[model samples]
Target chain A: MIIMVAIDPSYLITQVLNGLVWGLVLALIAMGLALIYGLLDIVNFAHGAFYAFGAYVAWQTLLSGGNYWVALLTVPLAMILLGLFVESTLLRRLYGQDTKFTLIFNFGLMLVIVQTCRFIWGARGKPISIPSELAFSVNLGILSYPAYRLFVIALTSAIAIAVFVFLRKTHVGMATRAGIQNREMVQVLGVNIGRIYTLIYTIGICIAGIAGLVASPLFGVYPEMGAEVLIPAFVVVVVGGMGSFHGSILAGILVGQVATLPIIWEPRIAQVMIYIFMAIVLLARPAGLFGELGR
Target chain B: MLEVRDIHTFYGDSHILFGVSLEIKEQEVVALLGRNGVGKTTTLRSIMGLTPPKKGTVLMNGEDITHEPIHRRAKIGIGYVPEDRGIFPGLTVHENLTIAADGVGAPGGNYEDAFKFFPELGKYLPSRAGRLSGGEQQMLAVARALVGTKHVLILDEPTQGLAPKVVDRITHAIKGISKKTSILMVEQNTDLALRLADRVYIMRDGNIVFSGVPQQVRDNEEVQSYLVIS
Candidate 1:
């Protein structure tokens, strides 16, 4: 008797696509965290809270009969305003004093925001409907995929390109990038370092907001959902290295694959795979994959 | 156009400058000369508001600005080129030149002027500052200061470690720049100080030991006493 074991190509393709999409989202979060840490020297533990807030904002917009495109614009704007207010009133005071104060303050902020979200949204997770036009799947020669997932990939790719161009081509972006290496040098040249700090923080928060708003439909909007992504995103940041942009992107993809691919064979060990990878990488290269020592 | 009067700067409990006073006229080049760690750089730092003096005043063009921030001091026409040159090692030469030209009223918008001052920097405009040679870095530091609106340019040890030819190149550029903008330089090389400065002050143990023209300082026997290795 001959026994045949079948391998499903569609399953593999779906897993790979899922990994890529999730990796891009994680990259967005990690990049924002890294940018804030690099320029303002703040670890921004409240970053995930900002992401959750963005999702809530999107939910509110959608509830008011706004389309996905409208929520897309409104979420980032709302987050930017909140970021500016928080930065000027609270975070600004902690700067130049102690990093520990900032870290604790951000942790407090995360708690406060998560609690506020819980009080408003209640214990039940809210389901967000995908846009009517994007509800269908597109046939790609081998497998059919959701149009919205492709849209997410395209949108993130565009944002990544824009960010790369901004950092490489513009004067302000170049100064910001240079400031990460040496702040005093930028200051002596007469650039007000404080103003740059505000801009960097706001931009970082806005990016987090974007990630949250987009992911709300896929992952039901819930209060503690931020923590679910936050833990793994921190892992991505550690694997990418502090203050390293390209490092975070590569590490995010690696992590997404490690987190998702194992589920096909054995679902139990999927979560543990990322930590094992991180530990091995840290042991081999303490500075992270592309991170510089003593940053 | 600058006056630093009775400045007493301190670094924590250890006092660095004791009643140090100096003056720089419009378009004049004043050099502060001393051996290592005699508070020459401290005086510059105090004036630039990096390590502000506890008891003293710094006046630029008649406005007292002792408590001003470092960037504010730069905005008010005080361009400080520090000892280490303060180059943004990751940025290109062109980016370094343009990063701080946000305000108006200083003579920093002329690319031809910067290129005319140091032609060697032209080739390195696209290269990162960390790759440049010592002389080129010094030229870039001075060039960055001049690119913005700055009336009083403060330089600390511009030729500390360089080939004699590079020193000549930097000194020649300073002389050219000094004709247009007032300069306050700190130099360990007494000959270079005397050659470029209209007036010279010798610092010793956190105080101005002697102040006179280069010839008077060269002739004074007391100057030798201050120069002795501690």
Candidate 2:
């Protein structure tokens, strides 16, 4: 019981960096979930399936002789078309109905997507090697870290900032924020809410698609790949406050650390630590860290 | 310029408006007055297509628009200031006006015109709307309507909860606005309605029981009884 052990500072720093990289990826995915829920009021149980589908599509592109850069460029655009089709054909009919209908519908959609992926690609996971330019590690002051992780961090930060500016500055972005608060009033003010909904849903899917493609090299591609991150992403959204953009980013980083940092002392608790953190946060402030009071 | 002809509206299975009919001519202020639960707001909702009349028609410039969507109605130059003010509390005053301006394709130059009515809004353009005082929010609501096309403005109880001082300012704004846009308002304050309106219609049991000029309403004791004015 009194045994003492020395820890390597470099290993600890590496783990922390890993956590940061993972968190940013989670933030990107969770932000999509938050955007769809904020404006459409749909819980979107199928969001994770969309992520898995994106990864598979990227894999297929690579198999057809497309490089990682090409897959990245085209996958999100393809997801936009899929989003347009899904929202207009299926999700459009569910608006104005009970929230339960959409939830159940999305749950069914998720099953369909996952099973379809399994049938097409088989049950085995598919590997996607990192791009040649980013295959090595870069030396930080404390330790060397994979260059791809650094690229992910920089790219995600840029995307987050771009989305923040879009939401705060542009006319359509302002209408979207307004729609989140009061959709009927937005309509009364003469904004076409249906078109706004379509655009938001498309953007949400596109972001999730991008997240999937970006994370594929690290985790490989599989039918159930999205299922692994979906629950944690939900945790990030709830901890950050549902439907809050800034909250998702902050909570994503926090949850990422909680999920990863404990591995040095106890590897068994890594999976459940995020739930514990969420429970403590909920106990302190039931509305979540960034959610509005009484929401 | 706007007419509601024998419109009947229902919420789910329960009927709310029963064959209500009224009209507003070019640049005229028409007040629709009735007691609570008498379907006064429902009549306005029917015209705005918030609750389309199941068995009637609403016409703007002789074109039927009863089935038109709410945003379409607004885009075609029908500005509404709902009973609750309908201010987007999360947005800034400038953003609120911007939405209305964008909705009707109102030019950026019209923002100065809106500010002229309530210069107070210009100072708080950056502040969140929910943080505004009751009087200021009302001014912003009226100012938002003015930023639109000014074809026909529908107001529901714009002064329901404001102070008398605020009421005076709102009254002044409405008086100034009436010269440019046609107004169809449902007001609880009979004296204020009578003062601002060129024409008045009294409703009871979902029907227009009386219609005449403001003086005719004041002189008639029966119309006063329906409004229950002391």
Candidate 3:
């Protein structure tokens, strides 16, 4: 068939689709990390674990004969409780402590979670077939794309919009933002800053968990899957600028294309693209693209 | 009424406040006069539970609140307008007041009366507090305290950096407020402290060396000399 003969057009389209799909999910994951860092001023090293946990739990729900939509509701709730436990028990102790302790402590938690996941899910990557009702291809003018990719974009964008509005419009949102800017000032205003911190942390992890559940349809469930994207997530966050939501989205898109474009033409060097872009951006603008001045 | 008894406050073992003690009767404007670094602001912070003075009993209307959190102190009718104004820079004047007022319950009894004092606040309710002039910011800070039943109002250096006219305006505003709520004001300007103070305490080295009525403050030549030198 001529389709096999004409690989170039199909290949480029596939790469673009791959980048956009992964980028959307990656942004969701990074947004969670950034929100926690933005408010608490703490690097949540266990965020990748939260993403992995989300995927595993979503997979568990599916294997147990649960509706796919149930994953959306359950994964976030599970991660929220987990986040509350972790923050109240361990993260709370490191509030005024050095960031080095947080990094070390969370990295330890990450190892434990990863090994535990390996113990339960085993070493092999688990296959989670996309729901049959939703399995279809689209003819977008000259190129065909997966319907699942569009769902990934739409669903994640919806989540992001809900989160953005929640943080910007509501009373709790205003209090949380205020607490981020001045926790002591918030306390003076009769707000419970400790409670707000826990709430922000939980919401952040829930976003990551939701990201995992959303991406499970695309990437499948696996233990090492999180490690694969962890570095890139940090790179995207740094590129997007710390604490600025708009910057994170833009950076995620840019980094996504840089990786995919290279992979389309040359598959092996695709992995290096994100790190290269990150280093160049770091050297040029240490604060990231839209990072706050002096940060 | 407010009382501070034997409050020992330390900032990393430097001992900023050394068992300092003071009291203010209801509806009285008590001025705390001291040279810089003599723990005046620290005393205000201790009373506000901002610093949580090490060994002290801060009582508001006979209620023991030495262990009360800062927010609890705020809710329990202690309105603190810090020396810096603490104008929520990103918040508008309206948003600023709303944050202080929008708790789950009704205003703690005297909200309507408090709004009448700062009639100017109603004019610029939509404006950002950070953009307001020094005097206006000071007014907003005071009004914020007033809007939520100020049983004990603490103003730190309300006249510290203001121009002479703004200072006079502030003096009048504070005077107007003194009729409704008890005030514990910390000021370096002796004349402002003296003229406005119902009772004055001259602080030296974190201890009350000279405390008396206005005539006593005016008559103490040594304190007068130190104020000029300070």
Clashing pairs in 1: B106-B149, B108-B147
* Model 3 chain B weakest 10-residue run by lDDT: B102-111
Instruction: Give the alpha carbon lDDT tens digit for every residue of A50-165 in model 1.
Output: 89988998988988899889999999899999989999999999977768899999999999999988888776788888888899999987999999989888887777777878
Please tell me which model should have the higher TM-score, number 1 or number 3: 1
For model 1, the TM-score of its B chain against the native B chain is 0.94
Better of 1 and 2 by TM-score: 2
Which is the leading candidate under lDDT? Answer: 2
True contacts kept of each: 0.69, 0.76, 0.33
Off by over 4 Å in 1: A1-7, B8-15, B103-110, B220-222
DockQ of each: 0.55, 0.75, 0.39
lDDT, candidate 3, A107-179, per-residue tens:
9988888788889878777777776766898888777888877888788888888888987766677666666
lDDT of 2 by residue, A1-295 (tens): 1221367789888888889988998998899899898889999889899999899989989989999999988898889999999999999999988999999999999999899989988889999999999999999987899999999889888888888899999888998999988888888877889999999999988888888998999999999888988999999999999898889999999998999988978999998999999999989978788887754
How high a TM-score does candidate 1 get?
Answer: 0.91
Give candidate 2's root-mean-square deviation (CA, Å).
2.3
RMSD of 1: 3.2
**Ranking of models by TM-score:** 2, 1, 3
User: Can you tell me which runs of candidate 3 are displaced by over 4 Å?
Assistant: A1-17, A93-101, A262-295, B103-117, B123-130, B133-135, B225-230
Scored by Cα lDDT, where does model 1 land?
0.85
- Of 1 and 2, which scores higher on DockQ? 2
